[model samples]
Target: MSLYLEAATILESPQTTSLKAIIYNPSKPFKSPQPKLYALIVETLKFQDILKEVVENSGILKLERKLTPLLSILLTHDLLLTKSGIATSSGPLKDALLRHKARLNAEFTRARLRRGHADIKSLIGAVNAEHSRESEDGVTKTATGLTSFNPRWVRVNALQTTLEDSLSSPTFHAFQEVGSVSDMFFFDVVRKTYYRKAEILPNILAIHPSHDITSSELYKSGKIILQSASSCLPAIMLDPPKGSMVVDGCAAPGNKTTHLAALVGSSGKIFAVERDRRRADILEMMITKAGAEGIVTTLKATDFTTIMEGHPAWQASYILLDPSCSGSGILQRVDWDISKLNLPSSDTTSSHPSKKKRKRDETLPNGSASQPEERETKQLEEEIQDDDTSRERLQSLSDFQVAIILHAFLFPNARRITYSTCSVHAEENEHVVARVLNSEIAKERGWRVQSRDENPLSTWHRRGLVGELSDLKSSLEEQRRVADGCIRVHRTDSLGGGFFVTCFTRQVDDKGQFGGGIGNLDIVPAQEDKSRSQVLGDTTEVENQEWNGLSDEGPNEAVSAVDIADGDPRSGKRQKRKPGKAQQGRTEKTNRQFQKGRKGWS
Candidate 1:
């Protein structure tokens, strides 16, 4: 995935570069044996040496890396199969692997010896045992086949068909069939140890993590989506009643939008709004693929904030707001070919430090690059990081976020509105919730955090952190309840990534105006400076670390040093950043500092 992204603008972003590469990869399923290509890339990337020197090595082109790995791993794993085929350290497999160890090493040595003009077709033939002549050339090798390692978790897309029906079909039988796997020689049959997700989320299945279910017929037909158990929380917590109306603010690449469609069924109405035109197109495609055209209305290129009174969405009984944020809690998976794993110099310019710059670079220990372009990208990342933590940025994002929620609060029929983010940062999660709770709209409409006991996900072991609620105006006891009401998923908890979600409910009086009628609130947007100062007060704690969605270091991992919150929002397990230039701008002062940085540091 990273190799294909070499020429793209997303390559410079430290966040989600690998994930985006996979999503936008040309080899994805499109009625081709692209699944095989995907498998080949995934397995080959596990070998760290090959990935770094050959694929991620900037000296190579994007197309070259893709072609080389296909011939190398795919062909080798295919022809050099054991009797059972699966590459595991078992009785027969262990013996087979030991037997081929010497020969496999020799082939890799040969490939490296002729790296610049290596004939992949010929190397593939050598690896496949096609040439008896090459076999006697004093080469040692490791086991040729690889054991596939795929994480378990399957989401039943209730829109296309019921989970029961899909599981009962012949398509599911492949899990027990040895030959059905992509590699014909692989021996271990996929396990049938599928367990229903605990609690009210009946459609979610937690299968044994080792099984490869991506190629199942149900998955191919969109009867099931490979979503994590945690990602399905927000929609379930919202619990939108059947035949009701709902709005999915920030609903692009619509997983929750379609989930809402399933709950509402054909009789219900859903307005799926996305701000970006391109992502909206993808959302529309997802909606169509999920068979939710009748239930979901695609509001393409429409910002949730622009949605106001008199719009059909204003009458929605429920709203799911999952706005963008620093994706700190997002799980960082290592699977890309050209990753942030290394900040290499582009051919056009050298990223290495000069004699003077080497001295300047030593001042900042965490700083990684010396190249002007690389430094510029890092500086922009730092600025964005700074801005996100700055009271100004948080307040600005909070105001817009609160406005979106407040807008939902104004809905005449709104009852349950759930706010979520894939960010672990408090500003976007707890702080935003606290800010909205203190607003006049919340007070007047009787909007309060839904108690955990009432939420379907209340039984989840990892609830919201208590410390983040310190800023909320509620009593400590109430704050604890509010924290319990919120659902938090850790990145390493086997959910797709870190996430946070909480639902708000309004109790209306006998007066119809407050009960179910759409009433207007004259809200004056708060000044940025005032909002910042008010939200942060006079504390150094306000300057929290920005949560890069792709960072493996989670918020909870740093809880001892910083009291940052841990959670996620959205029912899709993870949220992706909207398309934009990742590298923004650089300043001269920053450049001068990098000019004195040391070489070999980055």
Candidate 2:
């Protein structure tokens, strides 16, 4: 996940040129005994990097500093590995790290000599405290080989498959007794886990040991979709009308776009927009596969800010925006290269001092031509690219989010817009929402938070002011309140990816009918009838089975249904349980916390 770390750091902006570097020279996962990478990342802050520079320029100095350090910690320690491979620090890994450490100390010493002693000392103190946390409460390896697999659950959509059908297959035990409202299930093997959902496609399930389901017959035929419940939250909140004009502002590779299309059935018009041409092409393929080609239109939109300015393809009544962000919300293992554990011996290369270079050159705190300027352009480029900067991308991205909000609310008929991201950053999520809601444009347009709850009838009166979101007034007056009292989902919560979604409707205007509103299309009878058939067919079969009871006649009549064997762990357990599928999801959600992205808004 250094990709997650490097991506966050490049966004930081610095006032002075302090060289910062992350030593990831290990070509393989680090051997055990490697000093905490978290501390190294914190210490790296002593040098300025492109990430820090961008963040400073964006005026999120504090966030840049805080997030970059955390990203470093996550990258160094985490490993996305197979069950058989347990990484540890070997001699080479240790030596490379030690050499890198030496270079950083020397750099810090030189930097201290040039700057304010107080500032330098404060940074060092922060680094020390961060390292101390790692030393004391640092993570340790748990189960492996057989134990490493977490029993992540997957759901079969109610519209297609039944929960019982997904679980009746062998290797799964019924914890139907331990479930929730989202129609989720758990494997008997791995306990205590944050479940993964299939977000974009269909109601597909993940097998504990099976990772090749994507190429299977069912997935290829569109019988199942791989989507996460967290990813499903925004569309849940927006609940776009079945037949209306909708705009997916950042719709590329159409996850939410297809979801919106599915929810709308076939009557609605969904314009799936992507800025990148290649991504848009891929999105079209995805749309075609999902059988949603007719209802959704694909476009190569370079700037969503001007989505409505010059082009008049569709006056969007609803919009879904899942903009790019630092992938801090991802909760997966991180693995490093084994070779990075050790540095090459001096004799391995030339006897000259410069000939034996340090791995510290792999990354930098700040961009500088101060040393070997012209000769190392390629090296610098590689280093810069390694650090993915969200601030630079977000400078345009956040503005794009705001611009989409403006356009969504531009016409009186465009009532619903769901602004969301995979980022946990408030600057990208809540702040962008606040900026638009507080501005005169949103107010004059008469767009306000449509019920904060997905239930539509649930209402709350909330409005925004500039100083901070907390100062704003909500009809219910809660600190977590959005500008118009919209619900913003965090990765720290159960369902919904690290995202922020706010549904809006126009409040002031009565007649702005020219723009295409959701009222345009009458419900398509055929689409509804097909869904009704799916439900009725399944239900009727189950009812008929129930009507035919098991028999007890003679020795040949002995039946072997899936009754629990006495040796099974849950054989005798009984409790007041919730509905099987729904209960499984709700229960797991409560027990497991949200997966944190390596770095975030804080």
Candidate 3:
């Protein structure tokens, strides 16, 4: 296949997969050189809007029946924007495009003039500036086409080195230090700069996204981590005391796990639980890389809900629950917007007739016209399918999120718990918070939303939406207070992405009991002959037993009815568990009681 056709096929890939991953996939290699193909796709996407307009105005797709919308757009991009013209052999396809060279050039010049650019260089600069603004906003656009500030947030890993030592290291020796994040946001494109963000978050810095820091020695040594400022909020908000026991309920890809380790120091211990074996491996690698192997215990394939009274993590005083939800707040790639380009319609009839009328059955060199049209239709359908965020999906996600937090509440010694999500929806944020706060376990354990004045992130201006908490059984004053306690980061706030975090706190008696009697809440059966010491020592061991659970990564993972049925507020039915060796000793009565208690939480 030609480069244009191959690049078009790559563009048709699902948005969930990263472009780099598709380009560099070793199993299914492309005909073109990977680097050259990747560059062509990226550069073409950068000028997609301009090329779309130029091609449509020139009527190239209409005149040349063989050229598809995507093909015309790609070929036209190189023709007008790149130093080298079309990178293809001299064929009928080339001849068709070359026939309209004069008209295409005129349309390209017209597009520049329409955008108020005096020259091509000035126009290209404007496009780069616009892209920079979009990156800073993290792809969230306002009504006025303005976006929030989104700088590349970097955290100095305290486990390996201090922030001061990192800044003075050889990796950042050439970088000019700026006074504010805004300075870095509007930095001179040619100069290297960074801004220290100490006012709200410590050991964090903001740098322009254009700067490539992944290759630096600091990053390679794990002395620095590429985490968003919003993602760092939970660890900072929990504020676990030095040498405290903590649990990261959904820890994987362990950015927050390592941050918690840095806070607890070598004297503290953290149990990072991840149910998925694949993600657990990634979490283990991150823990090792951050030099936190001694501090964090990897609980691979163990569900947070399974950590009952007998489990080692049940005694954790501090817990951070960043559970699964619709990742609507996550920052998207700026280049993904290129997929929404309005290419010229392929059905438009040609104004000029052929010199000698040829039969319509004669296929073009690439393919028949109908083939490209079908492909275009299929691509549009895939785009729409991938973007689906139906209300039913959100409801399912909210139910699972509420279940995770309620399970965290069951921890006898969990004094402080912070529940967070990178979701803008109230169904996953304020609604889930309200549901958990109103749960029977929370009421029995005295778990309540930590007041704003006591929260570590109280200085953050954006708070939870009080209007979304109308369903909560609280007075208007109380609801407002609860909303004020939650910290919300808007996608346009430039703090990185849209995020929501709220801390829950309660008092415990000397015997690790809240003021109420222990109810008959027999959820999971206690493990026999296991002590805290034994469990803690077995941190390095991966559990071979499989537990049905959902991934906290995002909405992509499927939610098992058996795993979340107890906490799912709307699920009225349960799936029967298949009898296996793991269920040998369990009686039917105990299973019934477990199911009954699970329904009570909802």
Question: How many clashes does each candidate structure show, in the order listed?
Answer: 35, 72, 3
**Candidate 2: where is the Cα deviation over 4 Å?**
1-212, 301-313, 336-396, 454-497, 508-602
lDDT of 3 by residue, 350-456 (tens): 43322334222111112121244464343223222333467876776776667677777777777899999877777888998889777787777788889999977
Give RMSD to native, each candidate. 18.3, 20.8, 14.0
| Cα displacement (Å) at residue 336, model 2 | 6.7
Query: Candidate 1 lDDT, tens digit per residue, 185-233?
Result: 2223324545554465668765543344544556545577656555577
Name the regions of candidate 3 deviating beyond 4 angstroms: 1-143, 336-387, 507-602
**Model-by-model lDDT, in order?**
0.52, 0.40, 0.67
Candidate 2 per-residue lDDT over residues 493-543, each given as its tens digit: 333223345666565325744323434423222132232223222222322
Q: Candidate 2 or 3, higher lDDT?
A: 3
Let me know the TM-score candidate 2 reaches against the reference structure: 0.46
Worst 10 residues of 2 by lDDT: 552-561
Candidate 2 displacement at residue 311 in angstroms: 6.3
Looking at model 2, residue 246 earns an lDDT score of 78
